[model samples]
Target: MSEALEILKKYWKHNEFRPLQNEIIDTVLSGKDAFALLPTGGGKSICFQVPAMMQKGICLVVSPLVALMKDQVANLQSRDIKAIALTGGIKSDEMIDLLDNCQFGNYKFLYLSPERLQSEWILERIKNLDINLIAIDEAHCVSQWGHDFRPAYLKISNLKTHFPNVPFLALTASATARVKEDIIKELGLEKPVLYQESFARKNIAYMVFEAEDKLFKIEQILKKNPQPSIIYVRNRKSCLDISSQLQTLGFKATYYHGGLPSREKDKNMSLWMEEKAQVIVATNAFGMGIDKANVKTVIHTQLPENIENYYQEAGRSGRNRDKAFAVLLTSPSDRFQAESQFINTLVDKKFLNLTYNKLNNYFQIAYGEGINETFTFNLNHFCSKYNFPVLKTYKALQFLDRQSIISLSQEFSEKISLQFIIPSKEVVRYISLNPNGEEIILAILRTYPGVYEMDTVFNSALIAKKSNHPEKEVLAILEKLKEKQIIEYRSKNNDASLTFNEIREDERTINRVSKYLEKQNQLKKEQLKSVLDYVKEDSICKSKLILAYFGEKDADECGICSYCITKKRSPKDPDALSKKIIELLQNEDLNSRELQNRTQTSKDTIIFALQALLEKEIIIVKSNNTYTLKS
Candidate 1:
């Protein structure tokens, strides 16, 4: 215990362990398998990391996300602790080198995806290493009922046979009782001690509001909090739109999604992390490895797919133990939209068979012989070629990736190359004719000196920045130049790539995974219903409702949640509220937010009072959307 505390203070510079961390570490130190269920931001990494540092040999960490693996490895390396990660796309020579390093280079931690463990060569190399512990991150992925079920995780238990004496620690942020049981059984933990910290976040004020204008509500929440924030949307378009809107309203805002180039994503993330951007509007793709503790508010503009996702995203707030907010703004149509997005897009067996067959045919793979074959995949191109719906096909591909039938690496990119076919004078004349293309054409010619001789690959983002134009505008200009025959231009959206891990027996492969698919779809439907029920509920405290969903039944009511506040005002007098609103408006015109602040009442009561006044013609909404006494 003293050595563990010393390791924490020496490396992590933290005086004390977060709640339950010390106990979990002690269990592992005593040579026992442990299952730890900590909430998001509960320092789950430390539970395994600190104890691993106190041991003799390296800790083998099996994670699901490549990005998260790299992040943890980098954090460890930053502290002068040697760590290595074996992610995808590594050449054999480099991989052998990395394995040798782990075998003899005194590396303290080795992070790799579960998919990597399936390779016989890598597994054999791992067997020779002095492995002290096995730490499984996101352990719920092994469960059929977990929010993120990855079949690759089921193969992790095979490691126990290789390292029979090593202790295994399974950690997750959220899981149901059923998921917990699945994790324990699937991971083959022998009499594993279970440690579950309470899921209640006392500093976060859970708030749900029904608003006609979600953007308006978001603006009000941000204005009131005025600290670092994240607003989660469902798509990339909304990420751009809302971030732009927030910037227009004088907030330093940025956006992030999987589609953005890695450079731009890092730039935007840096802006938000360094506090240059007060808010970041993003899709679910953000916040996996991000740990900014000062996020004062997390607002969900649309309904999430499940309570697990909602709870995890909401819990990102208040990590610094200050009072923060978790707000969900809903409209009448959100339920329909949520269903259309999540449930409607679910892939069935028939659709999956179609997708799998089309994929094999598109790649020209022969029956029973495409094992270990890799292909450069462009999802939009595939959809266009097969006349398939993009979302459903993507979902099907994701299912295949999760089942380890194929590895889908979604790293968005664009490959651009061009050659000046016509003479240099002709290109100059064309640029003059199209004034908007002048800057970009000149920047490209200057950047790529050999463009006049042969087709040269160019960095479009760099050219766009050099020419003071957006990347889309630069690409459009290049397209126009190609149309005019001044240059031979080619641009390809190389969005992602796929590697087949099984023989090309299309229908048989689909049949083998059909039950998992069906059960998962049913689970998704149930999860969606839970989300809707949670938002529709008004009597139960929001925090309590969330805690109970995760199998915590005895959580006390949080007085700061929207439900508790409304319950406190249940016996309110409409006349009294109306009078307060009237007096506040008489002095000056006030919007609903201002009125609520002045009267210190709930938003529902203010809206009710405002509606009554409007029906009786005692007050009117001005053209500016403010309330005023009728003259």
Candidate 2:
């Protein structure tokens, strides 16, 4: 074994590398661009991580999801690796400190969001830092054709110009043939070695059932599997409602969505991770960074907008190489609803112009006024002031952010407590008045040595844990101190900033951009239609259909799928199936005994043919042994 493989086995406890992991690592280590299309739970992280360990400087991972970056950093720290995520949630001073650490400290990996790429300070720092490899996770986002396209990803290609020697590795769990080409073109990668694994999960049985009552179907599915599962809904409200319904059905369920507070989100996630909750009903926001490997099933209550999203979510199950199920429960109306959503949600040029105008009005800025000036924006208030739907308006602003016309900081509030508000001499006197509070107050003072002298934010929950009190108790104590004018406390919420690139907008340019967005939405609709056709088509093997969609050819039918099984049980000819019995069974429902008497053929032959027809869905079994035509 090579030296790199030895480190991988020693640290990761895996004797051998997964299919494409070793090759990917070798390509990256050799200082060449590589695009790796590994499915979810396929150890995409290890591809960069192992090479990062073997290489000389910090590996910079540009990820789009903040939560996912934090999760990966936490996982790395758990294994005694030095990692940090530079995100907008922290204070500017804190971010500077972290950047300094990455530059000076012996850190192996520095994960950052794509939005951070435009920061002049960050760019300056990167110019000097010894960045060994630049890895872009979810590289599909760089492509306009991808499901989750982000404009800021376009700035990443500039890194290649800045660091000419650094190799770039783009990794994504799901991407189409068009998206793959777009990723390569957008990221400016060389003619890199392309590694795409087969997009087939044999352990996951793909099943779709049409039902009027989806909750009932979910209950039936749970009763059959009764293992760790995820129920995906379309919106945040559905996440809560379905979870409540599941709880009433005697299952321990929790809900997760973007609307929940950070601490609450953490608590709910921990509950599910610890197996204290049997299931999690969530929106698409819940699964990005989740690494649980034993999920027995993944149920989607509605169709996803694209197959890429569907495949990534479904691939979450069966990570342990165990048999799992991926079921989609749909109704006839859902197809139309999804189509309407896709059409209506398109961020065309007119909407973008109107939105840009409204945003300027909100900031009270003229065409040339708002440049480099940063202020927190209230999206809800702006929408209300302009009489636009909040969700649509928010989406429009997101599009603007993508176009680099503005930047949005997702709302995040941080818990903060002041060390002291009174003079140093008055602290002893204030504590003497409240003897019971004096011990706790003094203990906090001693615990956080330099907090009073400097502005540093510490985790309140950690402080409470060390102080031997509930978090609420610590918060209350801080509140009491604040009321007495002995200390100060405050929290910061997530906000948005509008940054203009230029003073004037050309009308024709705006219209052209709008037309392009409309065309993109139309393309997305076609992609979705293809996905739906794949799901409902009964003639093709499910696995073969998916592999073919990703541009792989000559794929064989997966014999384990329902389509293949049904084919195997189908009768060669309905006309030769005990003719007299078929005649008797076609006219009315007849029991086996009655059919045998009328046909004069043995009961076994009649039964066998009937079973074959039933399996082929040509006949329906009516009461006990009675049979009737499917129509």
Candidate 3:
């Protein structure tokens, strides 16, 4: 067995490697950059992780998702493997300590976000650490064609010059040929060995229903497939609405979204994963690295923004390679809504300029004054203040961020924290004087003894439960403690972190990145069109259609898809209808209506047959919309 195989067995307890995983592992082990294209739950993490373990030095894994990084770090730690994630929301001292531990404590893996790669303080520290390999997860995000493109990812290519000896391994679940080429070009991967698994998912039956009542369709699908499932909606409100509807109708369902408190998200996600909740209704934010194996159904209530996103989301089903369903319910308004939300929002240079000036003005930054400045931004407040749509404003900001005008860190829901400033002996004296809220103070100390040593997460509800008081009373006590200068408390509402990477410029200079922004915006419009095409398609097999979109040549049709299944059981069969049409047209020229009437076939069937005949030159369409036999 290879060294990587031995390491995998020792750590992950996997006896065998999935298809192409071993070859990908060998490519990385040979100090060559490799791009591993695996499907969701296809074990993409293992390819990098196994090789990282067998190497001599620490593997610096750069990713953009903080929650994903957190989960991976926790998993590795549970197995007693030395790993740490240098994500956002860490204090300076804590960051220093974490980096120090990695350098000296023999940490095997250090995960950092791409935004952190640009920070001189962090990069300076990274330079001193002995590194073996650099793994880029969700590497598709580096390409503009990807569903979730981040400007910070462009900065990751800098690592090549800094660590020339350290090979890079980029991994993503879904990427088209264009996106794959872009990832290689953008990341400056040196003659990277590419491993692309076939995108054919035979067990997943893709179905698109243009129904008027989506709720009724959802019910039917759930009843038909009563296993663990996920329902992906567009926003947070829909998640709650659908999940509540399911709960009212006697279905075990839970809801999750990005806006929910982290505690609530964890509870709901856990309930679904552990089979306590049979179905989970959520937005697209839910399933990044989820490991549940038996998701039998994955439904999309509306059209997705692009094929990349739709493919990734739909691929969540049938991870066990068992029969499962991926259904999408669309309405007449879905097409218009998708176009309006995605294509119409494309900002030209003028809109970019206007939003750029408004943003700097809103932040109160003077021209040629603001450089290396950081501020807390609440996107809702900003949009509400300027009457800007949330989606458009977010896109504008992201475009500018990627253009290097500013730096936007991952938006984390801040937590309520408190640290005692007083001496331990004085704490008792203060409590004696403030006896009205003595129980709450003692509860805090009892629950989090380290709160005095460092700022720790303070749960008000847990304190209320322990103190036998209302949550309002608990909040009052914490505020009173802060008033007495006994503790420093931070509220929970803190949101976005915005840093001006350059000095504030006049509106004229803000258009410096307009050409680049325009190109990206146009690319987005094309991607959205591809998604709409997928939704509107009805002739080809859905499975084969998706495979072809990802550059699979001559993909075989999946017989289980709704298209193929419906074709199998149709009354107005095209083959039979074509024969009848040819028989009628052979005698005399006939109008389309007459042809359909004579053949006793549906209009769609007649039209399909006529088109096939026209393509084959067996028939000709003369004036008056009539078909005739070609002489």
Candidate 4:
């Protein structure tokens, strides 16, 4: 057996590669730069991973999100492949140590976020490593035309100058023709071999409906499908509201969003991922780390911001190649709100400046200070304190980060923890007083013995299960212990973090990136328009249109999309009545009444035929509601 195939089998347990995967691997193996446009669930990672496994050097992967990096690292480790993801919340010494390990230790894969590339120390160390292959996942982010463009990605081009001999493999799930070409140019890939697999998901049925009552529509869709499904909403509030409505209707449903506490997010995600809940309602935050292959349906409660996003999210279903459905429920208000929320309300340079200054004030960072300082930014608290809209505030911060003014990381769900402060003997004596829910108290003591020594993650659910008490009661007992000064309790939190890449310079810093901000704002507006156009357009085949938009012009009809199904059901061809009308017209002029009396079809159907004939110009409307031969 070939070494590549053998490695794939031994590590991934796969005897063969997916479509186009082997070709991509071969191109990379030849030491040529390659760009791979594989759709979601297309196994893009294996294209680089397997090649790296066959080689004797480390593979450097620059991923965008922390969660994605961590997940892939964990997966690699599970297969006993040594991998490490250098992300945030680590001190300089720790990062140096990790890098030292990568240099000396035999870690096969090194996953680094794009933001990490901005650090000169990291770049210097990476240049010294025996990096044989450089893989850029989510490569479309390099394109200004792409939906999630990050300026940090542009710095990746610098790698080519240092590791000029190393082959660069760029992979993205979705990208337009412009974005694809732009990715090549931005990354400075030298005559890279480009491979684009068809973005069309044949196993996914596209269903679009104009929903007057979204709740009723959701309930109906859930009742009919009843398989594992994901419902995408536009906001955290709607996520909770819809999930609650579904659960009240007796469907096992839960919600996930950035606003939820860490434990809640984990619990909800576990329920949905384990099939304990049939539906998971969430914003765009739920799909990055998901690997469920049996998702029968993906419903969008509101318009997606772009076609690329919608396709990637909907394509999550039917990964096992079973037939699934991607349904979009839209109201006129939904479109309007999408437009208003995303386009009309984008933060301008002025707003960006205001937001920048307000943020420093919020963090209490003095002017000309706070360089290289990191702070846990509670987005909700910042918005509430500044009386700014949460979504706009978030967009502004993202823009600031993209412009390299600051580095903003994804929000993390931090768990509540507790540690016993008193001595073991004092703890025993206090607990002997029957502080309440002795079973839960004992669970804490037994489940995590080191809690007395250090802060340990507190799981109220497990305690509740063991104590035969409600989760609320478990929390209450924990708080009671905290009140008694017996244990230190830290509440669960959801907070994003921000690191000032430069010193606080207020308006000067915001002005430095004003042009860049304007450029990104325009990109976002154009991307939104693309998605809205898809939602409103009903005549084109859903698959055909999307494929064409992504630069696949020769795509045929999917034959099962909503548009194709409706086209097949409709009588587009000339009916018998229409044929009769043409025959009558060949003989003599005929009025509507005359046509109805002469044909066996209904009056409306006959008139419809006459209109059809008139449109063809084989017959002409001589007068109002009258017809005659054009000749």
The number of the candidate with the highest TM-score is 1
Residue 266 lDDT, candidate 3, scale 0-100: 91
Clashes found in each candidate (C-alpha, N, C closer than 3 A): 0, 3, 0, 0
- Which residues of candidate 2, in runs, are more than 4 Å off? 412-495, 506-509, 569-631
Local accuracy of candidate 4 as per-residue lDDT tens digits, 219-313: 87788888899999987667867877888899999888865557988899999989999999999988886789999999998888888899999
**Candidate 1, superposed: residue stretches over 4 Å from native:** 364-369, 372-376, 407-478, 481-506, 570-573, 580-604, 610-631
lDDT of 3 by residue, 165-221 (tens): 888999998898989999999999999998888888879999887767788678878
Q: Tens digits of per-residue lDDT for model 2 on 1-631?
A: 8877987987788899988999999999999999999988898999999999997799999999888998999988988889999876688889889889998999999999888888888888878888999999999999888888888898999998899889999999988898999999999998788998878787877776666779877887888888889998997667877888899999999989875668989999999989999899989999998989999989999988888888889888889999888888878898888877766676667777888876777777766566666777765446646767655777787766677666666652234635576776788887787776665676677766655553344445555655666767777887888888777666445445556664535354366467557756777888888778876888987777777777777887777665676667654344665465557766788876566546644445667877777787877887686778778
What TM-score would you give candidate 3 relative to the actual structure?
A: 0.77
Residue-level lDDT for 4 in candidate 1: 89
Q: lDDT of each model, Cα atoms only?
A: 0.89, 0.79, 0.84, 0.84
- For 1-631, candidate 1 gives per-residue lDDT tens digits of 4888999999999999999999999999999999999999999999989888988889999998888988888899889899999987788999999999999899999999888888899999999999988999999999999999988899999998998889999999999999999999999999999999999999999999998888878887888889999999987767877988888898999999876668998999999999999999999989987888989999999999999999999988989999999999999999999999999999999999999998999999999888988888777557756768767988899999888888887454446778899988887777777787788888998988767865565667677767988878988988887888888887776657789999999889999999999999999999999999999998899999999999989999999998887777666688888888888887899999888767777677788889999999999998999989999
The TM-score measured for candidate 1 stands at 0.85
Q: Which residues of candidate 3, in runs, are more than 4 Å off? A: 376-381, 412-497, 570-631
- Relative to the unseen true structure, what is the Cα RMSD of model 1? 7.2
Better of 1 and 4 by TM-score: 1
CA RMSD, predictions in order: 7.2, 13.5, 14.3, 13.3
